[model samples]
Target: MALFKTSNPALGTKTFQDAAARYGGAIDVANRMTLNGTVNRTGILLICAFATAAYTWRAFMQTHDPADVSGLLMLGVFGGFITAMVTIFKQSWAPITAPIYALLEGLFLGGISALLELRYPGIAIQAVGLTFGTLLTMLVLYSSGLIKVTNKLRIGIIAATGGIALFYLMEIILGFFHINFVSINGSGVIGIAFSLFVCAIAALNLVLDFDFIEQGVNAGAPKFMEWYGAFGIMVTLVWLYLEILRLLSKMRSRN
Candidate 1:
């Protein structure tokens, strides 16, 4: 059985195992995944995301019209979803599709962040700082062996992540029927607590992503898997940032 297991759908339990099996004996030393390479690819993807995000952010600021970037936002929403699905199913294509996914997500995030920033000035920067701070803290803990990815912790995080995902999906589905979760979505105590819980879970996911990527490297996954690993980290980071943004917005609304 594969020892690697992560709550991240992008980096499933079998991800490294399957990649190793397929590329076994075919990967040269230079073509094997490396921690440094994955980090570099992750940096590249972040830059790609930031570039387009800046474009949309500036557009919104200049026009002060959501309509101007509405099309791009929708495109990012749906296109990023499709691209992520493709990358998840076809891991080998991650080297190509991952950057595309980042760019699309940037469009969506930029528009949303700008809209929120307009309403709650400085919230975006606060959220960004918290998001990256949590990421760095988690990285330090994980690297120091202070937070071990034991089976129990792994399973707990996975279960919590799944529950959160299901709740969000239900919320979306109910929206079409005109049913809304006012209390949970409002700026009330319940909403704030829920957001805090979600933010914690999202932060824990970064640890799982790190462990999964390390396992991939140890398994000698193909060099392209470096991109895949970085892609997985990006997915977690996006989720973390969005959750932090929501949490900050909720708190700001109370004041």
Candidate 2:
């Protein structure tokens, strides 16, 4: 049985296990995954994301019109989704698809952040700081063994994440019918509380990602798996950043 599991769909329990089973005997030590390699790949992905994000940010700032970048935003949404699906099914293609995924997400995030920053001045920087702070804090806690990824903790996080995903899906469906979840989406007490809970869960997911990546490194997976591992961490970081942005926006709206 796999000894590690994560709430992150990109880093499922079977991911490393299956990779190890299939590639362990074939790949030599030089071509096997390593912790440092994964970290370096993750940094490269972050740079890729930031690069495109800066472009979209500047474009939006020049026009100051959401309509101007709406097309790019949509492209990022659908393109990133398709690329993520491809990477998940074809893990070997991660070395290529992962950077593409980051770039697309950057487009989406940059447009959204710029739009929000117009409403709440300095909100974008605030969100970025909080996101990285939370990431660093979680890393320290996980590294210090203060936040153990026990079976119970993993299961609980997985269940909570699934529930949140379902809720978001339902919200999207409701939008088709012109239904609005006022209390949950508005800048109210309930909405703020819900955002806080989500932020907490998203941060906890970083711990799970950390644990999952460590397992991948230990399993002697192929070198390409390093890209896949970085992709998984990127997924979690994106989620955490978006959640933190939403929470910050909600709080600012109340002010």
- Residues 72-104, candidate 1: write the lDDT tens digits: 999999999999889988999999999999999
lDDT of each: 0.90, 0.90
Q: At residue 63, give the lDDT of candidate 1.
A: 81
lDDT per residue, candidate 2, 1-255, as tens digits? 121345787898879878988998998999999999999999999999999888889999998999989998998899998998898889999999999999999999999999999999999999999988998999999999999999999999988888898899999999999998999998999999999999999999999889988988898889999999999889888898889889999999988
RMSD of 1: 2.3
Give the clash count for each candidate. Answer: 0, 0
TM-score of 1: 0.96
Position 194, candidate 1: lDDT: 93
lDDT of 1 at 230: 90
Q: What is model 2's C-alpha RMSD?
A: 2.3
State TM-scores per candidate.
0.96, 0.97
